[model samples]
Target: MILLKKVLLAFFGLCAGGVIAAGVYAFLAIIGVFVRLMGKTGTRKHIFLYETVIILGGVIGNIMDIYEFPIAIGGFTGHLLLGICGLSVGIFVGCLVMSLAETLKALPTISRRIHLAVGLQYLILALAAGKMTGSLLYFWQKMASLG
Candidate 1:
């Protein structure tokens, strides 16, 4: 049924979003570990690499969602708005992770605390980003309905 198809599309979109967020977080965490091992000199390079991966992952995820859904529940304006919102959420999460990493770096004495704090911050950001991405997909469904 049409309703079932819509539900499936929404589910696919959510899965794609979750995959992208996980990729971003994992990439950053790996880079952080690498930087810690390599010392301060390689930190900047690793950070840039991590950011690039996030951006690419976000783009691919959005494209995959659109391809899988292909139904506009609202209108062009709504779809555009949703896309922008999703992008904004991704960027915000990246920036938040970076800031938290910087803050953690300042307290070298509390290594375990720093790791725990960074991990928690990343988890929270991922959850927020996932929620925003889901909203975007919902808007997409609404756009499709309007058509």
Candidate 2:
């Protein structure tokens, strides 16, 4: 029965992650437009990093949910706590990316890059982040289940 519940929870959590990612994408789309309109192109490089962080957070939350962290603790409050931690991690990732991006800005050839390349760059970042986080989660679950 517990195994079944965990499976169901994992399924639901994955679904929720997709929903959250979509919602964040929509929100980011709006913010991107707003920023561009406001002539804030200077911050354009950071936008993709923020999006990557949000996607990573949602995915990490989904994985954490597979272990039923919220129920193990209390309930909604535990979920909130987990969510906050995920978000804090995400923000940290974004800050790191932002800092690295700033350093790259000094490259004379960076301006020659095509617009479409930015999309690819973020896509790669998201994929890499998700892959690493999922693998970490898998190992964590394995170790946890052994105990």
Candidate 3:
């Protein structure tokens, strides 16, 4: 019985990990495509609008996951809250970076450098958000196992 439970937990963990990874990848890919599309127009307003939507989406997704899943496991609530907080911070930072980059456009070279940095920062944040969601799923599974 114990072995079976361990096996099930392991299986679920992998599933959760895969789900998170895939979701994050898809989200990033979509954002990248949107940014590229906006870049074609070469307008600061469009870029800002795109960034706003992406940040809003990220926040909404995290909130949805927290509400959708059962948060009965140890530390699950705290983790979820922290994840939400982190997502908010990330969004703010991403927007700030983008705004700064837009302002630096006159110095073409600096703008490119800032854009890369901002992109990387957002990627890291998105990955972290995905990881938190995965952890929440794993915790849910473990809690379910107890019953």
TM-score of predicted model 2? 0.30
lDDT tens digits, residue span 16-132, model 2: 777887886575454343254234446566767755766687677767765666556555576567667666666555545444454456323453554453465675578668966
Error of 2 at 60 (Å): 6.0
The alpha-carbon deviation from the true structure for residue 82 of candidate 2, after best TM-score superposition, in angstroms, is: 17
lDDT of every predicted structure (CA atoms): 0.66, 0.61, 0.63
What lDDT does model 2 reach?
0.61
Candidate 1 per-residue lDDT, tens place, 1-147, comes to 999999999999888877977886677566464354336355565767866865787778777766795646466676677678768766666555655666567334444655664566566567667977887688668767767
Best by the lDDT measure:
1
Q: RMSD in angstroms, candidate 3? A: 17.5
Residue-wise lDDT of candidate 3 within 22-139, one digit each (tens)?
6964755544545544566676577677767776876667667656966464466765685686666665555444444545553356436567644665655676679668866876
TM-score of each: 0.26, 0.30, 0.27
Q: Is candidate 2 or candidate 3 better by lDDT?
A: 3
Misplaced by over 4 Å in model 1 are: 33-147
Runs off by more than 4 Å, candidate 3: 1-74, 110-147
